[model samples]
Target chain A: MEMKKTILNPEGLHARPAGQLAKVATSFKSKIEVIFNQKTVNAKSAMSLMTLGIIQSSEVIIKADGPDAEEAIQKIATLIDNHFSV
Target chain B: MSLKIIGQKAAPGMVHGPIFIFKKGNSEINRSHHLFSDFDPSKETLLFEKALYKSLQDLENLKNKFTSIDKEKIDIIEVHQSLIDDPEVKEQTLAKINHENKFAYVAYEEVISLFKNMFSEIEDSYLKQRVLDLEDISNRVLFYIINPELNFSYFSYSQLNDSRPSIIISEDLTPSDILGFEKTKVLGFVLSKGSPQSHSSILARSMEIPCLVGAHELETLDLSKYTDLILDTENSEVILNPNINEVKSFEEKVSLFKFKQKQLFSFKGKKTETKMGKLVPLGANISGPLDIDSVIKNDAEFIGLYRTEFLFLDRITPPSEEEQYETYRTVFQYLGHKRIIIRTLDIGGDKEAPYIRIQKEENPFLGVRGIRLCLKEIELFKTQLRAILRASNFCNDLGIMFPMVSTISEIKEAKKIFNTVKTELEQSKIQIGKKINIGVMMEVPSLAWILKEVSDEVTFISIGTNDLFQYSNACDRMNNQLQTISSPTHEGFQRFLKFIVQEAKKNQLHVGVCGSIAHHPEIMPYLISIGVDELSMTAQNILTVRAQIADL
Candidate 1:
């Protein structure tokens, strides 16, 4: 699957969105990877995401692969679009 | 009478003799030579195996010698023991010794040196600390292989575990390693290698045990010589080798300290009201679920600010909702119908959350964070709120509050979410009890101007003066280049809080300061004077603050 690029809404992905992304990432059967800068981590792992320590409105790349890879990336993109504010 | 080092007297008593110092790194690095070269595949495998067993005994003996079991030291020994017994370290070295005609020392060096290089390449900090442990183990192995039956019976522990309290002098202590000392038996602690924030020191303070660190480099400092000691609590000073006159002075001061403490304790469960019958509530800032003990022991009437951040830090995984539920449940049960105002996840400032990735902001303090983070992360927020709501059922007086609130909209938004969670749990038939009151921190400037409008939406208000002052003058409180926000004595902050106090009273809502300003002895009387209902602070500052408030 191709990587999707998005500006992190609601400043950067803070405690809340990091948690939201973790929760959502855990929901699907597909494996999701989020890359910010050069660091890549499992988007489903809060521990891994937290270690990224990104701030507001950062450019983040979400990559996913599996049975629902397209749907997972779509859901994540929508979450970044909807839940994480301008 | 021997060469005396006036080190921190870790225990009380007297011992007179030539003092022997336990020196570290004294064992030479080349001590590994014979163990490596002599362990030939054809002959010395059995001898090599015999040496491994002997080293374990040496470790056991060293532990028995210590005033306490040094876990780091034990950890080091275990690593070395494991390495020696490993199939690679011994079998490979011995094979090389026999096949290649290498010396036993050369064979041994190859085994351990490989581990040393491997350890240096690992990236993790915790894993890196293990390299030192490995080296320490290597030293023990060298001693065990070379000396054979040089029994480590030289160490003694007659004075330790003698039913008398001790002032342990150590180079360092691990966070978990401090538990071996019986609390009552550890009168004080002095670390040659620790700080105010070290686990031992923090544990000592929480236990009300006196401690002083960074003055204990004299490891062999005669503990017996310094045993006639008194801990000067106020100064963190250990008065060593006290004469009769010095003892008399401390003894005289001891009663005065007791009397002062008695005065502080007299306010137990008492209203913060003056003789004039004005109610003045005293509260505390708690970091975790465990800090409630200090709050209860101090008899704090309520929890002012329950910092919910420590729940996330240093943990392997995020605390599940059930874990959060049990945690909050304990706080609620402990307080029992007393107001415990929990501040939700007030991170993204100096107290950063490791579990959440927030990008680097030019000014994180001014950036979108705090209550803002709460609104954006609904699932996590929902988990916390649900846990909190679940806990509130167990304690009717439990309350929740949001921190760094800048807008009335945030208050309205939180109230809405709180209701949604309450309803969701109700729909699930989760058997939660009682709806808890919610409050918003009035730290923003515009909120100060619009208190009547703001107070109508919330159950109570807490003035976060540390940030309120910082925001009021646009000064980063930590910035040395910026203007200082000193104390209540500062005219501007005094005015800001005064405005908050006056506005809060007019709106008929309870408001209190929960910043360091709350615990300031100098500021307490003024806060009382300004008509704030409650004062909340870190638990350690409560007793002295209560004393200062009693006067007003």
Candidate 2:
């Protein structure tokens, strides 16, 4: 499963929000990957996500593949939509 | 070998213990020239996996250990945790070991370096700063891979547990190492190289660990010969292999230090009062939310000066209302009910932001700055005002203070903008604090003479004696030649303070001094005697100042 989302944080994908995203991605069994600016990285790695420099309003595609792929996409999308408060 | 090494003091307090020479970044695995072909790939893989597992567990434990700290600090540990066993990092490391014929530590270092370089190239300063976090995690994993026999817990380490706490002697330490170490089991730190401003030293100071840095003699001496050592950060020297007399005297010093610390701690919950029963509210001058812990630890009656300029100084663009609101609200959440006086953006003197462009002037200090700069940049001023007003809803006692105000109109203009922002928010149905106090920093000397006129514009005033001293005496504070002239003891400056305090009392306005001079030993008495309502100083000085006030 795959979904597209815009980073809502003005200081986008900094340590705190990136850590939240990675923590959420790691909870699911899916092989989640986030692709931004044609660079693909593992979403379950905060360091990997931070290297993307996803600034405010930058749209990216989140791809997940496993038994829980659908649920993983739903969870990650919610996190991003809520400005990574989760 | 008995020797004395002089170093710069990074933190205070003293202890004597055996020297634990921490060889950071000196793992044999890191220095080895062995290629993947020199060893079994399967063995290297297993070794890497074990190190990775141990590192993950340590990260988990560190995260739990730091749970009581602020959320941002915990987020750092969590970031390291997520990246420790990251499949991406693992895949890259395995590729280096198998395909590139590199050892596990070498492979891991290569991957971390790659990410570090990648992060350093990024334009966002905040993301680029995370490179330090990467280095910290890499060091931890490398330490585990090399020294599997050494237990990761510093608290339960055999050498530390055998006798007195060990003084950590390292070339330098990462901030995380300082944070993750069991501070109780450690006497202090003696780094051969580091500056007082280094993050590690800052962490050492914050953690109240006695630390000495820049001991160049340590490089020549064989550390193995020095089993016992005295870390006297007060004297800025470490005594190696002291004589019985030296030991006995040093022991007395240590006990005295501990007694002084105990006395300071005892003042934590007591009211700051002089012998004459005059109650003086003591507060801390903080730069941001990070200082909230120290402020509370010192039992400050309030935050007298919260410099909001830190939020604006570092970024490519001025912080949006929401960003500033979040920052202010976080401070409010931490302070909870403590009266906080936040100074508006005082930029363009020593602090310059790329986003806020001011024409280079002959004298930037006398040029556009503080309220003058904010007034010229009305939109920026409004944005900050809106944020402060929005966050004021979170705290009961919030004071908005404008800095370097020289005229009545400037205060009225700032208040006008603030009132406009407040009204806009109210019209939008936003709830703000019902009674947010207004104040101004009395930095301009001209304003001192007209306190009666300015007092009506604001409920409180804080004398910014640093700038006020320099400006009043026509002495450049930065110039060494003007040191004598700019001294706070200058009869002119002393008289100015007394006059202002008298004027403030007559005007029925709460007045405080948020300046370096507030904690000056000789000047504190005059300030207290003059009936200043509050004295704001650095967090570290709170306990000592309180004790002094109590004695007086």
Candidate 3:
């Protein structure tokens, strides 16, 4: 399953939010990856996500594969919607 | 040949010392690693995983042990922790160990360098900063992998063995990395990559260590060729392998700077009185307890302006009464015997909290802010008042100041709320302090002319000159084009301030100037002569202001 979303954080996917996003990704029993600017990185790795340099309003495609793929994608999409405040 | 590198001054000082080229990671591992003839990928993989786990534990321990007053510092540690927890780094290192037949530590090092090189190419500075955090964790993990028994988590000066006074030159340093170095042995720092706003540079400034950041030319220099170095932050440059003449001139500058500092230190315990023997109390304007050390160091007579906005800003929710009370009590407890004047939430204008709902106006500075905002949000005002009144029990001399007060009615409304909170606390048998003074921040220009009208409502007035000057001239102080017109030394501004001070005196209201202009060398003498009762400034300016007062 995959879904597209735009980052709303003023600071983009910086350390704190990236860590938070990764923490949420790690919860589901699925392989999740974030694709930005044609570059795909493991969503469960904050360092890999940060390597994308995703800034505010950057569009990214989140892809998840496994039994819990749909749940994983939905959770990550919601996290981005909240500007990664959690 | 002497090499000169220009950079931004992170801190002010002058020093000459032997140059020490400090590298972050353990370089010994690179030399010791050899071509493995009979390689065991599984064993090496196991070792790598153990190192990673141990490194994570070390970071967790550090995070647990750290009790920093600044929440930002702890956030840095958490970032480092998450950086280590990245599955990509572990996966890449394990893959290298299993497939390429590399040593455990070597595989980890290669993986880290790959990420570091990738991050280095990034133009976004905030993302680029992660490279340093990457290095910090890599150093820790590598240290644990090689020398687990040593239990060395931080890079220390003892590793160098040579104890000669030196200026540390590095690619960049983390806050933890800088803290690990021996302060007495390090004369200064020259970083090839970093900004003055980096945590490391801020730490350097607070530590009073001379540092130059963003010295790109430093990366090109062959450090071994430069045995001696001169770090002159006043000029925002470092001279490596200085010539005989350069050394002599640097020595003279160092002594003169030292002499000036020594002279200022002598005025610490002395009375803040002018040559004419007119005494005035010099106080520090602090945001929170983090600045308490500096406040005591500079020998401030009192905390004239404690901006309480720090507690309100940068958080999603407003601080509860209990949290606010605890913070105020801690500050008051720390500054025992010394009088403390705390200003209520002075938000709006330049500072905006997302939690506080205010209409978006074209001009925020002229819109609802400070006391005006408080007046509208009665509950918010009362909660803060309740906290302050509760904390007053711990303080011998505490003053509650209302900011952005313009009209006499605003002052009356605020005091009325303050009295209601006080009575409520009293009815609950809360024993508040007796001699707590209520004051107003005289930032609104109109309030100055009407000081006498509101004299009975407020006990004291602290002139916030920055806003007063900006509002008086109708010029934005931050706009670079208006710099000349917004100058504090403008005759009208000076005369206006003099009038405010004179009015406060006539009303028997103790007045202090708690703004950038208080420490202005050209204006401090004039203010002293005009009978200003107190001049409040940042902790760093205390001694200099005291010295200036003595010379007046």
Candidate 4:
């Protein structure tokens, strides 16, 4: 599996919803890399997302490769598409 | 095999409606960024005025809705409206639109940003909601301003074919959304945002709805796939996409819950006493008159603590003594002279009071707050005292409590003001409750340690556990690192209670807990066992507290 970047438009990965996305992304037996701007980071990192201070209309790219690549992409993409609001 | 459900259960009823997620989509407008950049200054000014007019009109509509109280909910709209009308907010909007010659959308964005920063900085959850409510309203206002013709309808669960909603999942819910929903038809509420402290959670507690917040994998839920679901607020877990047996058990539990509620409500108007013959005077702490009806329904022994701070905060100045007096009189009259203990201005520390400015100390927990500030600012204290006293004659059982009393001198100073207010009311030839019971809080261990001495001066003592525990352990309960440090079940705290209990007995004075611990069920039994004379807690827990006491 190859990693690709996507732009994040919704203001900051705020509160715990960001951490939640990270947690869900890491739950699967997959290697996920979430790159935000110039900083490349792990998708499973709460601290990383918190430090990024990703504001609304910012962009982030999520790339994952695993046995369940389809499940990983589908779930992560759905989570992001929901504006990471939930 | 199941879709996930996560939300704060707002009101308890089962609904099987299709999931209609209320996304609050942005209302699109015809104006483009390029068009706005090229627009004439005169046109921009007109646009700003138009948007401002719409905002003001919406605010007026909100005022009528919140103030013209038809049902139970408080006029929280008034609180938000005050924020909207705040000088700081107004100045910011004026600067952004008129001075900067910015687009109406940019001006709105700047205003929202200002609110988000201001509200997020404050410590209290209830007050924080004040900011969030303002933000929500501002967002809605912006949405309408952008597209006046936009059709906006967002409900997490819709009643299709007139069936009850099965489960509602959301990121978070506004206070209005929770109140407007058909509570009886909603089975479970799960949210991506908010928890026990959020507005939705508080309402859910009020309605006894099964609510869960900060749950895992809610966004992953495809609720339409589920035929059977279980929404349990107590557990903060929703069992979705369940099998037949799980559904049967949940339905049985619903019936059982109804039976239990019947048993609970039967004791509604009756006194809450234990089987062991302990006179546990159950009183509800109220902040508003709307709460008085609940006190009546719950058969509250008395209004333990009437928080007067809510009236004082946010506004440019404190409410007029007449306004405060009238408000107090209404609640006191409604309760029919029941023992209503009015705690005077327990602001500062974590609570943000813009009117009464205090120097920002290094540690607010150890700063001059509560009684200290009240004593230092005698005029503020006198106004509040006079309001309570004027309402005193209207209600006979008017009691007063001074919070954050760390020493006897603080009580003495507070009492001196109390006496002055009493004499002033009398000297003015206004009839008042001459012999009112004045009490001091045992939040500081030093006060608890010397309760025997000060206990004689005041008629009674109320312990504020949230602060006491924090001070005793030298830990901030809100600090994630020290979260484990707080627990009443811990010995240092249990020992503290034991000391206070024995001290109250020694003084032959009454003792009650007006803290968060008063409602903690795990601590309640231990509290009763430890000689806590009276337990004053949240209104929602009063019934359950009574139930547990009955079980005892």
Candidate 5:
């Protein structure tokens, strides 16, 4: 399962948001990856998410593969869509 | 031979000490040697984990230390902790050690550098600055990894157990760095780069530590060779390796300064009076309840100016009336019978509250601020008035003063609100003092001219010379460019003050000078000679001014 979302935080996908994304990804039993600027990185790695330079209003693709792939994609997509405030 | 390096004086005081130079980036880290001769991947990874854990613990301790007092500092420490705990950082560092055959320090540095470079390349300036935080964390971890037995702290001064006080010479001092240091153990500061307006310098000044900024060519000097140094901020000069004669002269000056300070201590509990027979009240201008100790130690007769704005600053929301009342009650309890003249909120201008939503202005000093702001924000102003009125029931000597009033109408409007608040409080069966004196801060030059009209409306006036001097000269006191013309000693400014004093006397109104100028020893006699009824300054200056007044 895959989902596309735009970064809504005015501060962009900085450390805090990336950390949140990683934390959420690790909680699910799915292999998740985020693709931005032609580079794909493990969604559970904050350093990789941050290095993508995903700034405000930028779009990224989230891909999840496993038994709970659909659920993982939904959760990760919602997190990014809400701009990681949670 | 003594080398005299001139710089801008950021804070005023004098001290002599051995120099402790702090160069950023911890350039002393030994990059030439690897942590292990032959790479053992698990061992190296364990070493990294140990250092990371230690660094995290140190940050946690710092966060706890600052948790109660400083919100901004706590947030910064938390960010550093999160970065250290970032799993990706740990994973990447271990991958380098296992695959690349690199040592622990080397692997950590390389991985951290990669992230730092990536952050720096970002278009956002704020994100770019985050690279400094990463660098700070990296330095802490790398320091621990290099010397496993030694403890790691970002600020070296905090860890030093040396008994001798030292002067700090640094490339730049951040607010957190200043906060981390044991202030009493640090005698002075000389920075190669900093502005007087920077938070570090402001903190240094408030802490009363001597500081000199923009000391060019400081970084190139062999710091080890010039261990003993003299920081003479009065002369804006730092003396390196002074000769016998220079040291003797410096010692003489130090003794004279110390002697004067000692003499002032004798006058602490003594009455401040002229040599003839004129008695004047010498008091302290305190910001909050915390300063009551200084007020008592200095034997202040009253709190001439209780600046209430300190409670309003550095918070997201305005203080509630109950909160303000509790603080005011504590202050009253501390002072007991000692009179307190509480100046209402003087926000805007240099001091701003984001929650208030004041419009940006080209010249805030001349814009809607002080009483003008209070008038516009009537509900906020009324809340404060009600709090003070309620708190007045706790003390016999409570006075309310409005700031930045330029017209009779502003005074009338403020007084009307005060009366309304008093009535509301009384109707609610709250016991309030009817003897609470109402006054105005004689800051705006226009107020000085209309002393008759002002005296008709109020019981007293406190001349806020800092603002009066700036407003009268049309020069920003904080602007370095206007240093020459912005002086309070300008003859024209003195004449204005003299005129205001005369007008107050004619109207039989109590008048006082409560400003930084009132703290100046030389200016003390001039203010006394001008017939000002009282002098209020920072509590630290009370004894000094009193001793000077005794001599006069």
Candidate 6:
């Protein structure tokens, strides 16, 4: 399952948001990956998510594979859509 | 060639010394495969977790240390805590140790480096600054993994010798790091990273150490090669490997600074008088009894403004009447005949106390503070008054002053409370002093207009120029962005001062000027000419102001 979301935060996906995304990815038994600027990184790894340099207004593709892939995609998509306020 | 690196001047002073590069954490890690050869994968992962736990504990301790004193510093420490708890960084480090069979330190370094590189590449300057946070966390984890046996002291003050003063060159200094070093031994600070508003920078300023922040090129410099360097905060430049002429000029300035100090010291015992032999009473503004020695040493005639709020701040509860009485008694006993004017509790606004329970306001500077806070908390005000009255029994020359009185009714109300306290003390058979002068700090603009009305009620008036300038200019003195407009020397402010002095003289009231503007060499002569009967400032400036007055 795959979902596309725009980075809405004025600060973009910095350390804080990257940590949030990574935390959400680890909760589900699925291999989650975030694709930005033709580069795909493990959504479960903050260092990898950060390396993609996903910035404000940038489009990102979140892909999840395994039994809970659909749920994983939805959770992460909601986070990015909500601009990681929590 | 003398290379000049520019940065924001965090503190003011000039000094030349050998550069001491103090990087936080152990950056030099042995990446050799030997350390990782016998590494049990699960054991290595466990070691990494343990290091993270230790780092988190250290950060928490640091946060607690600064929690009461500085809120901004506590926020910085909290950021580090969150960075350490980031699940991705932890998982990646564990994966490297488990899957790649790398040492814990090496794995941590790789992950930190990856994040650092990514942060550095970000075009946004604010986001790019996060690289420092990443580096700080990585260093802490690596330090634990490499030297588990060695305990780390956040401030490595014991390692440096007192005999050899050095300029600390670092990527960034945490407030804890700056606090650890002896102010005397650390002559200056040169940072590769730090904003002017950083707590470290604020600490440096309070310590009076020359500091230059945001010197990006300092991180790349071969500090070992350049043994001697000049940190000139006045010019906001750091000169590395200065030539003969540069060294000569720097030494000349140091000698001049020393000579000026000596010159000022020569006038310490002499009466503060003009060349024409007109004596002007010079005094020191003290925060507490601790500054009594400085007041005597500086030969100040009296304690002009004893700020009493220090006792109420940084505490869980307001000081009791007995506690306040003891402190006031100590000051009065020490000063003896040297009259100490104690300003009643002036907390609120910038000097907020958590225990005081003031509502958060959009413009706290103009909010319920000083006498206004006291007016609302009547019991607290009465307790302080009773204490002051009790302390007055110890000495003859105790002057009581009310702060932040803008209207005649406020003075009338304060005086009513004062009379009630005095009557209560007398009724209790307390041996109060025969004559205690009552005064008001002339800070509010409205008070200046009604000086004639106030002069009848108060025995003396002390113009607190710090707030007067801020109030008159409608600028927040503490706000760095308003530096240009917040000056005390504005023509309008000068006119206000002149008018107040004139009105004070017409009403036959002893008017003195106290604040930063009081002892300023250039401002002193002008104030004297404008009929300011006395000037009070920090004890350190008494000698300087005396010398300046003598010259006039």
| Candidate 4 ranges beyond 4 A from true positions | A1-86, B3-18, B23-163, B166-230, B243-256, B272-278, B286-294, B307-330, B347-367, B377-380, B390-394, B423-435, B465-508, B515-532, B541-552
Cα lDDT of model 3 by residue, A6-85, tens digit = 98755577677889899999999999999999999999999888888877668999999999999888888888888675
Can you write out model 6's per-residue Cα lDDT over A1-86, one digit (the tens) per residue?
78888987544676567778888888999888999898898887765676676666799899999999998888888888776744
DockQ of each: 0.04, 0.34, 0.25, 0.01, 0.18, 0.13
lDDT of model 3 at position B66 = 50
Interface RMSD of each: 13.6, 3.0, 6.4, 17.7, 7.7, 13.0
Per-residue CA lDDT of candidate 2, range B452-482, in tens? 9887888999999999988888888789987
* Candidate 5 Cα misplacement greater than 4 A, ranges: A1-86, B23-45, B59-134, B153-166, B173-187, B196-209, B222-227, B275-279, B285-299, B306-365, B373-400, B412-438, B448-459, B466-510, B516-531
Residue-level lDDT tens digits of model 3 in B420-472:
99999999999898779999999988888888887888889998988988899
Candidate 6 docks with a DockQ of 0.13
Instruction: Evaluate residue A84 in candidate 3 and report its C-alpha lDDT on the 0 to 100 scale.
Output: 79
Cα displacement (angstroms), candidate 1, residue B201, comes to 4.5
lDDT of 1 by residue, B1-552 (tens): 212233332222222112211234323534555554534455444445556666666555545644311333343334434444454466566776678876544456577776666556643333344455455555555544444555322211223445466666556654323434455555565566655643445555545666556665356455655444555545445555666676677777777767877877776666666666777777888875446667878878788888887666543234567557777776777675677788887777444454465667888888767788878877668888888887777776666889888888888898899899999989998766565677888888888888887878887888888888778877767777664453346877787778888988999888878988787767778888888888888776677776665566
Number of the top DockQ candidate: 2
Return the TM-score for each candidate structure: 0.62, 0.79, 0.71, 0.59, 0.66, 0.56
- Which 10-residue window of candidate 5 chain A scores lowest in summed lDDT? A8-17
Angstrom error at residue B233, model 2? 3.9
Clashes per candidate (backbone, < 3 Å): 22, 1, 0, 30, 0, 0
Q: Can you tell me which runs of candidate 6 are displaced by over 4 Å?
A: A1-86, B1-12, B23-159, B170-186, B189-226, B233-237, B240-246, B288-297, B308-337, B347-367, B379-396, B419-435, B469-499, B520-523
Candidate 3 C-alpha RMSD relative to the actual structure:
7.1
**Candidate 4 similarity to native, TM-score:** 0.59
Of the pair 3 and 5, which is ahead by TM-score?
Answer: 3
Q: Is candidate 1 or candidate 6 better by lDDT?
A: 6
What lDDT is reached at residue B27 by model 6?
36
- Among incorrect, acceptable, medium and high, the docking class of model 4 is incorrect
Candidate 1 RMSD to the correct structure? 10.3
